[model samples]
Target: MNRWVKALRAPFFTASAVPVFLGTAVAYNHTGRISVPDLILTLIGVIALHAGTNLANDYFDHLSGNDDLNPHPTPFSGGSRVIQDGLISPKGVLIYSLSWFTLGCLIGLYLNWRRPGNVILYLGLIGVFSGFFYT
Candidate 1:
């Protein structure tokens, strides 16, 4: 579990989570109500996206020798050294990343079905595209 957390860069999930919380707060403030289910789903979707992005970054960085060339990798600076450190295989990382992306997209689709717009679909597409190519 510890290795998995390190591979997922779980500490950095706040970068994804804070915005979701703020969005929920804003919606509640405006409507005077909150749907707990939506909140939970949104959180899971965003975090999964975040985790997928992080893993994809690590995989691509390893592929391009970016992480390999880094001489001074810190917890915040360089990509997680899971591959380099042998905590997780590069193929495994890529698979996990894709799995997370799929899960996020599924949740996004569900949320879109609940709502009455294609906004979630558009956003999810943009996120997945950017994340996959962000290396």
Candidate 2:
């Protein structure tokens, strides 16, 4: 309803929790241990990453002038209102994008250290690049 609430992208945020559920399921299926508590941390971390990325995408798209266009809705745009509806500023989007991407990188670094094979290096690097390259 509101711009701020819309910006959070709650559905996207919830999707982050999918990783925790998936991880726990895999661990249980393989190790026979379903540790809900541990998964809570996983969920939190993942949620952060997802939220960060979503925010980053929103922010970057707005900054790049892509959101300001009046083109037909496509897969990427999905008809976002920031640009078309003039819901927010480009600078505002950049600030939000930088914030979320930074958060994602921070969490990703932590994850890499905590779990070496986290593929965090790959995920983080690509993710950061995507933020810019998705121009």
Candidate 3:
């Protein structure tokens, strides 16, 4: 349970929820009401995307030789435990990350394809860019 929690990077969870809340707020902001279903799906997608990013960051950093650096850095250098501390494996994290990311992307694409305007596309692109730079 603890390991799973760490893989999720609990601290970042709240930020993940923001999109759902924001999307709902947008729904309401213009019409004085929100779409509950949209809110729910947004939350789900957020969870998958954020969790996947966390795992990928862990896996890639490990691959980049930053994970093995002894004594740990000032949090400025790469390599965070999720794996280094034996909490998980690089392969396990990689697999989970890819799976979740794919799920999230599919969901996002589905939702946006139904006429999500530009918000969804912008956010999705931002996420992919973030994942690329995060390592």
TM-score for each model? 0.96, 0.67, 0.79
Q: For model 1, where is the 10-residue window of minimal lDDT? A: 1-10
Residue 91's lDDT in candidate 1 = 97
Error of 3 at 88 (Å): 2.2
> Of the candidates shown, which would achieve the greatest lDDT relative to the real structure?
1
- Model 2 Cα lDDT, one tens digit per residue, 1-135: 887556666665655676668767888899998656556645665665555566666666655566556367553453345544667665665566567666667766766787758686787787577644454
User: Candidate 2: which pairs clash?
Assistant: none
In candidate 3, what are the lDDT values of residues 45-80, reduced to their tens digit?
778887788778788878876667646553434444
Off by over 4 Å in 1: none
**Stretches of candidate 2 exceeding 4 Å from the true structure:** 34-38, 63-65, 70-79
Cα RMSDs of all predictions? 1.0, 3.4, 2.9
